[model samples]
Target chain A: MLQYSEKVLELFTNPKNVGTMDGDDPHVGTGVIGSPECGDVMQLQILVDDQGVIQDAKFKTFGCGSAIASSSLATEWLKGKTLDEAMAIQNVHLAEELELPPVKKHCSVLAEDAIKAAIEDFQKKLEGRTDKAELHSPRCCEKLNDCEGCGSHGE
Target chain B: MKLPIYMDYNATTPVDPRVFEAMKPWFCEDFGNAASRSHVFGWKAETAVAESRETIANLLGASPQEIVFTSGATESDNLAIKGICEMYAPDGGHIITCMTEHKAVLDTCKYLETKGYEVTYLKPDTEGRVSAQQVADEIREDTVLVTLMLANNETGAVHPIAEIGKVVREYRARLHSHLFFHTDATQGISKIPFNVNEMAVDLLSFSSHKMYGPKGIGALYVRRRDPRVRLAIQTHGGGHERNMRSGTLNTPSIVGFAKACELAAAEMENNVAKLRHLRDHLEQGILQNVDYVKRNGHKTERLCNTANLSFGYIEGESLMLKLRDIAVSSGSACTSASLEPSFVLRAMDVPDILAHSSLRFSLGCYNDLAEIDYVVEKVATAVRELRELSPLYDMALRDNTTGDTDWAQAD
Candidate 1:
């Protein structure tokens, strides 16, 4: 049996905001990161306002318990923080907070990476609008093609 | 909640308090090398080792002279299988064994295959029980030895060794004129009755840790009458275990093992009865609560303490995660890294998906009825939840969540 941290086990058994959110909502910044080979996949959606402050966050994870718990904790920490503050959430810090063992620390790293990737996508979109307003108007949806939240490829 | 309820008894066991008490003195003031035959200090150590050897021999109904100690079951198995092969290398150059045997036996056979020797790997039925007739059928003109395990570690399927022994005896007279039989009875000594005479086996292996004793110690039983049951030493060192195994004997561990063997001989009947009852209770409870559950191995020939089940559409690892508080095993612990289903299940012809979705509960003497009931409920709930979330289940049922599948009820 894999030894789970008490906090991680608690979070896994009773995860918060376990379902999906509407990523199209204007108030949220959605983060979805996954590598196909590892099979550790997750979808994270954080709702944020014009002030760059996160309002709400939700996730749907499809991996081990540590992966689920790590993603859940990442979302909970994202709420009430600015985009820059949320970007600062490191995988090592989350691992320390959850008391994850060395092997499971990768899960926390994945969660941290997901948050950063999501924020980077949001920043790219905002920057594209300022660089070329007319070109960026209808291209926001087109930009989503490169950013696969959770990286799940539909058959 | 008692935090963790350990159910991986096959891996190892907690030392019994009685055995620990018996060994405490040997670690301190009584510590002396058993090999030293010069003075009073050596005499005491030799006496302790001899007495322990006698006590262990008594438990297995073998003479004290026939008992030879080794590191553990793995070493005992290696010494018994490889040792005999090396000794008879010039003569009967063949070995026979089943596919479901432990890695100790299987790997040894594989290594022997690389050497110049004929080997036959017999396959068992769906129940994992190897037939005695199968052994008789596989025997060749120059077959030297037949090494089979008394019971399987995963499914707890007891082989027909007694019947196999009868066949071996007949073949012994025809072929090499003295074919020896060996059994890795590591998981069978105390859990079940094992009389070498009744089984007619030349060599039998037993592990101390399997019966609530300390680790790193085990013994092999060699039938005294069989002069042809000779084996070459696998290692060269200071002569020990009549020069077959070489190492300064671990006196404290030997003493603990002896005491544990004695206790097991005295309490095995009661312990087995209790374990069997608790095992059945848990099995019945799970069947009553959960649907689509399939059992693996023989219905009646299964060990009294083990119950293996397959809950379709859900992986056992995910189910184990859900029921983290209950500490039961699922397939091979090593295979967890690759997430491959148990090879034992595959050998039994179980489908890959169903094999991955299996779990095993091996009850111990310390486990009570309450723990069994509690675990049953927890396991049922976890299996149900995992099944509900499984896309495979959804596809199999064609998205019909309300209509219950009859597969569970039939099983």
Candidate 2:
């Protein structure tokens, strides 16, 4: 058996922010990374507020203790962070904090991927809403000053 | 029951107290070299070694002279395969083995391949069994050796050694050529019925640690009559083990091993009965309590003490983490350094996902019904908890509700 660190074991045994968020919720963006073929899969979801701050973070992972701990730590770190701050969370930080062995570095990478995927999904949803609002009512884009990057601000 | 219950007997078993007691005196008092012919201490050590050899031979239904002591099963396997291959290189250059064999056999066969020896790796069936016909058909005139394990270490799948032995014998007779049969019976020694004569095995390897004996000692039973099996000396020193294997014997461990064998011989029937009962209860309890679970290996042909289960949706390593107090093995890539699940399970055509989800619970003599009950409850609860934390489980459930159970097919 592998010797797991106390922190890794603790996080694995009592992972924070476990369970799922409504993937269909507009305020929620879900990121699913890794694959069962590789013997790990992580799903991380972030609920963003109107001001682009992460209101809540939840995750579910099917992998080793390291993988579970990585994602659990990711969720705990993701809550209350802006999308940019969430994106800045690298796998190295998780690896260092968890003191994962070299063989388990991929678990931290999976956690990082899950975070990026969640943020991208949230941005994509926001873009979709902006596009729909623009198509329906051009004035709605004006009312929402966040349409600068929507590529039709001047038009 | 202990807080951390040991259910990974297939990995290695704790030495029995009786066996330990039998070995205590040899470590210090009778520490004289068995090869010394002049001293009384030497005579005493030699006598003890001889007695242990006789006991071990009696258990295997072989002559005491046929047993060759080695460090452990790995060395025995190395000696059996490499020794046979090197000794009979001129006679034939072909060998046969299964894909699911332990690394000792498989890697040895691979080494032979590098030396231009042709090795036929027969594929096992879905249940992890290589049939006797498969062996017969693969038998070539130049097939010098056929090495198949008696039972797989991972799934506890028992191969039909006697039937395969019969096939090898018939083929050798038909071809009128030199052919030898070897079996790594490490996992099957005391757990199942095995006899060198009845199985028609020319060479057999087994370890003591696997059978509640001391570690670092094992034996190889080389057939001495009917068709005397000859092996090239792998280790050359002091001309020990009748020159087949040359090294000073591990007297204390050998004594412990023999005592373990004696105990196993006496208590095998009752022990097997109790182990089977406990193992069956554990298997059934987990199966009934947990959904999306499947048992690996042949239902009837597997070792009675081994239960290999694949709990879907939850990865094995994660589930194992939850059941911290329950010591078991998993076929998860994360558990291994190579990032691949058990090759034994893979050879049996288990899906990668299910292989990642596999857990092997091997019961032993020390385990009791109460321990079994605790393990079963713990496993059930752990699996349920892990599944709840598995996104795949959530997706699977959603897919089931929608009557589109093909979500797993996406991967």
Candidate 3:
């Protein structure tokens, strides 16, 4: 019943780089954001180099087709781009590229938020603020295996 | 089978060719108002109307005079609820209805609440069942009407309407109050056969489109013998429909509706058997192959055609998109285009995340084993694809494998 552009359908049907990277690697910073209740959950990972340029980007989302397409497009746009250029990528560009209706615009926003959160995680890793992992638990903020933040309640 | 095999029969059904054939003459050669009782054209039309009325009445196990046509289930529901309230609650009284009723019944009861009527909205169980005991507990001396749905549109869970009706009858006798029982049987009319007499029901409402009939026609069965129900006429035109409703008959649609009922009366058992088989095959296939899947209603007491499943960690809208070739609906597909989780599931206490991921596949008479197999394959593929991209699914897997993801210490 939704009017999906060919590009959106293409990316969603065959989304690229849709898996988790080395969450423990300092070069690989992962950002997980979005609410599962809203039908938008995006986890974007990026491998950054000393030059602050993204070498690779990957994403996995549990949301609508537009959200999957949006994050997939975000990953495609993230690689080889500097942090500043990646940050410059607005939700409007994603929405326009996907030809999404107004109702689906939030999906692009979630992608943008995932990008910002990943960049923040990458920067935090570079600065060696590992203690801040406490802020995000039950999710891979820093550690992928044993989550100290979620240590008490059995997940 | 055609692509996008329709599985939302609970929404609406295709008009059967037989029903269409029966209606075609009414639209052309037989185009005469039943109210025009002065000529041959009128007599012919009146005869056709009478024959159709008998057919519908026979299907409902009622008399021809008991059947009253309306625009659709919505109008029938409105007339029943408001008319009963007007006749019995002139000075004001209490009404009872459940939370998971179709909007036609719920909204009408809600409007009564605004007009100085005390309404008690009963909550169904987690399996989406409104128990007769719940209705009995809510009954009081002032309770004038009890309106509940026979089957939930979203969950397809069949409530014990007969028992609930008996409860209302008992309370009415005890209190000597004018408490009447009404049920919206739009989803369960022919799908699961029941007679108003055995149920002790005063009013029953159902739609034509839901049973392979035309879209704009429906009927309400009003009891005429035991206690005899009366309504304050909402329309006052030509005093048609025994002065209960006033409007020119929609001859074509009415004939179509009756033909559908006749066909259903003959073949419903076979269709239901086939539907149950197909539905169970689909449900079992998905549950066996997929993980974190939960059925959304009572297993045995549901419409044989419906299967509502919640796939954990998968967004419903996204799942529906991947299933474009299969005509199914997400739980929240009805209202608000923003993809909110189904309120029906929420009322049943389903977690919001699971509710967001739920899909409702309502099978119909036309669907066959081949279509069910195709649906199972496509749905399995779609769910697998979406879950592969779901970080929640990945995280849950990791947590389970590690036997650790306990974030309770943070609290």
lDDT over C-alpha atoms for residue A50 of model 3:
88
lDDT of 1: 0.76
Give the best candidate by DockQ.
3
What stretches of model 3 exceed 4 Å from their correct place?
A: A131-155, B332-338, B401-411
- Candidate numbers sorted by TM-score from highest down: 3, 2, 1
Q: Give a tens-digit lDDT track for model 3, residues A55-143.
A: 99999888778889999999999999999998899888998999887666767776787888888888888898763222133332222
TM-score of 1: 0.77
After superposition, candidate 1 runs with Cα above 4 Å error: A4-11, A15-155, B90-92, B332-335, B399-411
DockQ of each: 0.08, 0.30, 0.33
Which consecutive 10 residues in model 3 chain B have the weakest lDDT in total? B402-411
> Candidate 1: what's its TM-score on chain B?
0.95
TM-score of 2: 0.92
Query: Number of clashes in model 3?
Result: 6
Ranked by lDDT, the better of candidates 1 and 3 is: 3
Candidate 2 local distance difference test against the native: 0.86
- How close to the true structure is residue B154 of candidate 2, measured as C-alpha lDDT? 88
TM-score of chain A of 3: 0.83
Q: Whole-model Cα lDDT per candidate?
A: 0.76, 0.86, 0.84
lDDT of 2 at B404: 28
Q: Is candidate 1 or candidate 2 better by DockQ?
A: 2
